[model samples]
Target: MSEKFRAYLIVSVGLACLFVTSGVGYYGFAVLNTPVGDEFEWSRGLIMWAFAFFFIVRGLVAPFIGRITDRFGSKKIIICGALTAAFGHFLLSQVQNIWHFVLLYGLVGVGMSGMAIIPVSSVISIWFDEDRGRALGIATTGVGLGGFVLSPVLAGFVIPGFGWRMAYIFLGLVVLALIPLVMIGIKEKPKNYSNDKEDDFKSPDFEKNDVRGVFSNLSFWMIVVAFFLTSMSNTGILQNHVDFLTTTGGFKLQVIGASLGGVGIASTFGKLGFGWLSDKIRAKYCTLLSFIFQAVSIIILLNASTLWMVWIYALLMGLGVGGWAPLSSVLISKNFGLTSYGGIYGIVSSALCIGTGIGPLIGGYMHDLTSSYYQAFLFLLVLYAIAIPAILITTLKN
Candidate 1:
């Protein structure tokens, strides 16, 4: 194979591995929340706070991680992230107190900042331009695939057989195993690689601006704001769907959980399909479609009474939510070149993380205060409507 093709394969594999690790590590909480709450006699809100805390830590650490990737390169940062994630899972496996849960999950959050989409997508952005959106979409599809395949399987089988702690141990070991693959296979774009005797691909022209530069760009701010709102709405659904079904819709916990897995499966295809579509059309339009789809899903979820209704809502929501991941990165790459792409993406991702951190907390809190998630779902619908305008404004020339 040519060096360019080989580079794409290596970077794509690295992104897939990183997504699998971070998805499982970060989302393990969503599946295990009931088990943890039951074991500790904690309120669901309290258990969800752990996930919130994780996002907060991820948001705070993301910019630094991006700066490090920009300055030093992605290799060391990815390896360090993988190992740190392994350690965090190890600590989680042995947790005895709420504080232990907080501390361990905080570390996991930091590790997620290191291991998640920003670094992986940055590397892929460096490797391919013509097919960047599709490449990123394929790489990130790992997260949805992992969740689709692992969440139900782990919750139904592993946790039942070995308990949640042992499940954590197994997850930690699996993530640790990827470290060697990342180290051996992953490489930054070759210093010598070029296109057509012109150095354009070798060192693409872009301003080497910091996070402040990103803040000054109206497009960047619009993307960030829209993403924040979308993330908040998305997280509310993902984190609370099971509870919402069980408490208000009168469904069994297992049924609700499995249906969420169905959402995951739908999301896997959504990510890939929307990503390819972004390459064909404008990414901003794809993003707008995703938000609209998600808003409709949320409305459907609010009124869902039968299992079939829940399943349909899950699939639609999954598609919309899944599409957002790749489309967001593609838009960023189109607006800003690879120069400081990691840092700029990281800042936008920090906004997303912040929204995610607050979503579940507010969702759970609303349930606690109102005795239902109806208010939260309605709130999400409004946010989605707001996001449509935000996204439209992003497409306007500044």
Candidate 2:
């Protein structure tokens, strides 16, 4: 194959991989929460805890996975991740206790950590330069697309027809099926490959240093803090979305599924839009704009009682949340360079994952205590407000 075709092919394969990993591991789990809670007589808080714990595990292992990807490349890491994730999902289908469920989900998290963003971004970084933002944006849309297609499939068909157990099995099988694609399609960076963006790392003294070097830079920390807050806010809303709709708005599963699908669609557009914007304006400014979208969506959500209002909320929130993945990759490359990108991005992702883990737990428990999502959503809004200034500060001249 020609060099240009090979680069695009990597993107295509990466998108497919993310489609299964994020679809089954993230959005699919959200759809299953209601039925899973009902079957086990678990509270929403407990269900949220299970997911929170899973993401925490995913975060904890990300650095190791990134380092591995850097040294060994994507194929091995993806194969291993897909196998582990498939096993976890298969076993998760058999769990009768919450503890077993939580632990197995953690295994799934570990598997997904290997397969998702870090390695994909690392490979994409090595391939494209000038068009990196759009390339990353296009590749990561698999995340939103997965949510769009899988959410309805689970809610409307799989769970209803074959039960939640069969749904997990189906997810496991789909993940396993991705291994062949990776084996055949992915390629390591050529030995002669080089990037001019190395000069872009903000720290001069630490240019040759390891991951510790970036720690001394203020922009790095700002990016971390900003994403942590945004991630926590976005994840809190998404994880509890179905429960919120059912209890607060009294929506049915089919309707809620469609709403979730709407989020996926909006997010897909958000990723592409913000990605293209990253090339035009500063990455931090694009992030600020996305946050504005999210904050307004939350406001709409708080008072939403009608179907149209909820759909509006979903569109705004999805667009806002959608920017995080591609923007995170862009910000990292702009601030830290790509020589050690996998490890550095891994650390940022770890922090982001921590926020993702905590958000749902906090949102769920708040609902348990107050018996309403009003207080919980307000907490998220506060996080968004705090994050805005943090992101803006990252764009200032050193």
Q: After superposition, how far is residue 18 of candidate 2 from its true place, in Å?
A: 1.2
lDDT of 1 by residue, 1-398 (tens): 66677676766665567556545765677877778779989886777788888898898888889888987777778878878888898889888878788778889888767878878887777777777778877887887777876676678799999999998887788778777877776787767644333123221223334455555567678888999999988897789888888888999987887787788778878888998898888788888999988999988899998989998899999899888768888877666656777888888888888899889988998888898889987887799877889998764221
On residues 323-348, what C-alpha lDDT tens digit does candidate 2 reach at each position?
98889898887667777788888988
C-alpha TM-score for every candidate? 0.93, 0.96
**What TM-score quantifies how close candidate 2 is to the native fold?**
0.96
Model 1 per-residue lDDT at 6: 69
Candidate 2 segments whose C-alpha is farther than 4 A from its true place: 200-206, 395-398
Q: List, in order, the clash count of every candidate structure.
A: 0, 0
lDDT per model vs. reference: 0.79, 0.86
Best by TM-score: 2
